[model samples]
Target chain A: MQDLGIRVLLEGNNMIRLLDGLWVTVRISLLAVVISIVMGILLGMVMTLKNPVTKALTRIYLEFIRIMPQLVLLFLIYFGAAKAFNIHISGELSAVIVFTLWGTAEMGDLVRGALISIPKHQYDSSAALGLTGIQIYRYIIIPQTLRRLIPLAINLVTRMIKTTSLIVLIGVVEVLKVGQQIIEASRYTAPSAALWIYGTVFFLYFIVCFPISKLSGKLEKRWQN
Target chain B: MSKTDYLLEIKNLEKSFEGGTKVLKDFSFSVQTGEVVVILGPSGCGKSTLLRCINGLEPIQAGTILLDGQSITDGKTKWSQIRQKIGMVFQSYDLFPHMTVFENILLGPLKVQGRTREEAGIAGEKLLERVGLLEKKDAYPRQLSGGQKQRVAIVRALMMEPEIMLFDEVTAALDPEMVREVLDVILELARGGMTMLIVTHEMQFARAIADRILFLDEGQIVESAAPEDFFGHPETERAQRFLNIFQFEK
Candidate 1:
């Protein structure tokens, strides 16, 4: 264990700081994911409208997000936009904001696919039963869309958790950054510490994401059959 | 206009797609109370479209549809409210797959009509019993056969207690052995004086159940006559040709 340099993380609250940093990543991811789900569902509904203007607008927004990388977005929001717009945003806040924007776009597109996949007859049958527009959505449209969406959305959650690593580049002091700090501080004393620190970080991510993807797979198998 | 004796009336209906292909043109028809009118036509002859128009599924270009002497399609009453009075069953049963058989019937009565669950449950059970599907009330749609699903669809429509029912080839999706069971349910509804307008390819079933058969061709009604008169001696060459596709035995 000493040769592998696991000894460095054992010294001087390094593990504690890493765990605290993990907490930051989890908190930001959870907040952004919750908001993304709520706003994404509404955005998805709007995207499905028959209006050409709304369609074009949502299409542009989705394409912009898909085309631009998340790291560039983080830089734009954290550094460039903060200076230009005169908003004194914190590192954590900037990370959350950038992540929410990315997550919402992905979740909204997922919802749009789920909504459009439902056949036209479902709406017709609901209307023919005297269900109002809202009632049709509440009873028929939403229930079915959710069934088709939940498995895909669960996979998105794991993605968001893994992507939270990028927050370190924005100077958010997340898990990866904490590992780097531990490695830098012990470079001379524990020359091979980088391997163990990075390996521990990898295990940390697996611990968070493995169960979620497994759950998604089980749900998909059950629902499909 | 004074109150007409007809329960449902549609006049001067002209329906066209955005591409300017007209599906219905100047179509006028009326049904008295307790009447069962079966419409027969070649594929794409506006039989289904006419039913869809009456049920407020399709917007009409220039037409008036009145139910119980009140204009329904003139944008006066809400279509959701008016739709309760015009129950429609589609080619596929369209039962909400997530819901059970009883829940599908109860959804309209409970949510739209705002009836108590106890009242709707009793009525739902009775309707299911009438269609001989009481045992399957707790079953989801995927568990049922196609005929069983269509029967549930008819019961679902009937639960709304509409003034008229419109069936757009409700049995078209069923197998040959299954079609009889579905048609028999509609036949029972006809015998019990449940007013309906059916669009079906089953010629024998059409003759057996229709009080008046409207033979349609190219979005126009070529012949509207009593079942015997229309089936025995159709009035127009178009309707005769429409009938010639089938070699009617009985």
Candidate 2:
């Protein structure tokens, strides 16, 4: 019975380590999302310009981001590019770089969809008012587009946080990675320890993501009805 | 007065759509200073196209549009300068939805003329009062009825202090009860001696307000005369048929 009590206490220490890892994961995701939104709005606006070559380049970029899996992108940035360029990037830094690239592409597409959904008559009316292109964008276009973009972007942030778990594969000591290490260290004392540690990790992710998901749902419902 | 002394002149204007539909061909006319010219035509007759070309919103394939004797369509024409002197109001109010009534009216002056916020504000308030929308200055376009929105659009155009103003069916979008309110504002503008070219379907407005009227058909001016002469005894069969359409409804 004393041996059983020590095993349970050991499992509790693993749960604490996993929680610490989750803090790192959330930190990286929040920073990446902020950077992505800024880059995405600028890139999306440039993509909508009348230049054919720029438009084609942005199309190719969006397609590449869409087709390449995030894991492959992570490895390419962490292992391949870092070596080829002789640059030293920590696992956390590489995870941020890869996720920022991915999130920017997704956010930019959302911005494009939001911008195009605005009626063309809006432009016509602004032009009729003798508003130049810059005034039209500043006074009329951007505010409306941003208002429609907020909920979608919040949903993307939640997606980014969830996807951050995949970064553990690149050897970042995030929540799942810490959980795995804990289970590996305790394999001898308690075989059932893996289930408890992983269950705790699942709840940790849900705790971070559930509130954002609920916020998105409420905003969508409010806007729709 | 010589035609060259007119406030605006259009010569040999031609426009075509991408699908090869010829909308306007060799359309030409002129408006004198302080004159209200009502352009009468059926739908798809290039009336709106003419207004757009004059404002430099739609580029003409071939033409010369001179405002105050300076050619606006010449390759050397400076758009920003010419646009500063001319203002356009659409059938759809097109008030900036994101802005309050006061901001909407002040945008043109503040941006184009580089008026300070305080200067634009004073001018904006007066224009709003003229349009009888001063109390709704804090309201957005979505908050106002269609007629009120149209009035805001007119005031927004006027805040630029344009040398000439174009009205493209301003009352066409208003409810019948609201039409008179917009027309009353327009008549007051006419009495103020502003140079104006209005495209409208309101026959009574043409009869009561316009100094002269031009009847267009198939993108060509079929007749041009004083409103009394044109409405009383139209020369062309097209003008007669055009006037007949307005009569049939009433």
Candidate 3:
């Protein structure tokens, strides 16, 4: 019988290493989320462009990003493309690039949905006030769009944080990978250490993601009412 | 038409939809300064179309709309500058849902007129007071009733300080109890000497407040007269029948 008691917390060094790994995971997700939001807003605007050629090009890119698996994307950028193009890409850089690409496609879809959901009369009213194109966007369009996009954007951040665990499959030492390494080292001492370390890692992820989900829900309810 | 004498002059204005169905054909009218003109028409009579064309919202297929001796349809006119002097109110009370009543009123003045925040706020507060909605200045459009929304929309347009105001059936969407409140605001605006053009089905309000009434049917103004004359003795048989239909409803 394995004693899954306070022995889990008896190892201070192990807990410190786990926390360090968790910090790295958070840093990558935060950087990727910011970059993705900026890129997504620009791409979403381009998606709404009236030119057929540009619209078709953006559509193809969106479809490509949607269908490809995130791990596959990581492998392609890290292994396939880097080898094919004779460029050196590190594991961490590849993880960031893959997550950014995935996050951007999803965020861009959110932005487009929010922008199109505004009532048509809003545009007409802005024009009726004799506003120029730039003024309309600055004063009328962006403000209303941002009001709607904030809650959804926060939700996307929580998703991006959880998805960062997938980067461990490609050799980045995130929290999950740190747990794996600890269990492998302790396998001779206790065969069930794998279950204990991985369970701690799962609780760590829950702790990190739950606050953001709560915040988003609260904001959505407050704004909607 | 005498140039430099009229505030606005329309000559044979015509417009058609995609399939070449004419909406306005050979329409002509003129308005002098401070004149209140009411366009009394049934539904889909091109009255709103005529108002939209004068404000440059819709392009005319043929004919010229002259504003202060300059033609608006010449393809060289700066519509934004021309539109700065004209304000319009729609039937649906299209207020910005995300903005407070005060922000909605000040947006035009601050953005278009380049007024400072202090100046815009002063003007906005005064306009809100004029509409009797000063208490609701910080409320969003969703918080207001239908009549309050229309009144805020009116104040927002008035904040532009336009020389001419266009009302496209402003009270058509309000409840019976709410209709008089909006009409009262419009009646006050007319009394204050705004160059106004209105389209309405409320004949009693038209009779009470209109300086001159024009009866439009199909696409043309079949009769134009003062309120007493147009209501007392309509000239054409079509005009007589149109008036008689309303009379039978009463």
Q: DockQ winner among the candidates?
A: 1
Task: Please give each candidate's TM-score.
Answer: 0.89, 0.81, 0.86
Q: Rank the candidates by TM-score, best first.
A: 1, 3, 2
Off by over 4 Å in 1: A1-4, A75-94, A188-196, A210-225, B1-4, B247-250
For model 2, residues A1-225, the per-residue Cα lDDT tens digits are 235423642555665777789999998998899999999988878777889998998889889988999999999988998789999788899988988998899899889888997778788767766677887788778877876888999989998999998898888999989888877776777677767778778889999999998988887665541
lDDT of 1 by residue, B194-222 (tens): 88999999989988888999988889888
Model number 3 iRMSD: 1.7
User: In order, how many clashes per candidate?
Assistant: 0, 0, 0
lDDT string for model 2 (B89-161, tens) is 8898877766788878877777767889998898888888878888999987888998999988888888878
Ranking by DockQ: 1, 3, 2
If both were scored by lDDT, which would come out higher, candidate 1 or candidate 3?
Answer: 1
Q: Pick the candidate with the highest TM-score.
A: 1
In angstroms, what RMSD does candidate 3 have relative to the true structure?
A: 3.4
What are the lDDT scores of the predictions, listed in order?
Answer: 0.90, 0.84, 0.85
Residue pairs whose backbone atoms clash in candidate 3: none
What digit string (tens of lDDT, one per residue) describes model 3 on residues B134-226? 999999899999999999998988888888888988899999899999999999988898888999988899998898998888889889999
Model 3's CAPRI class is acceptable
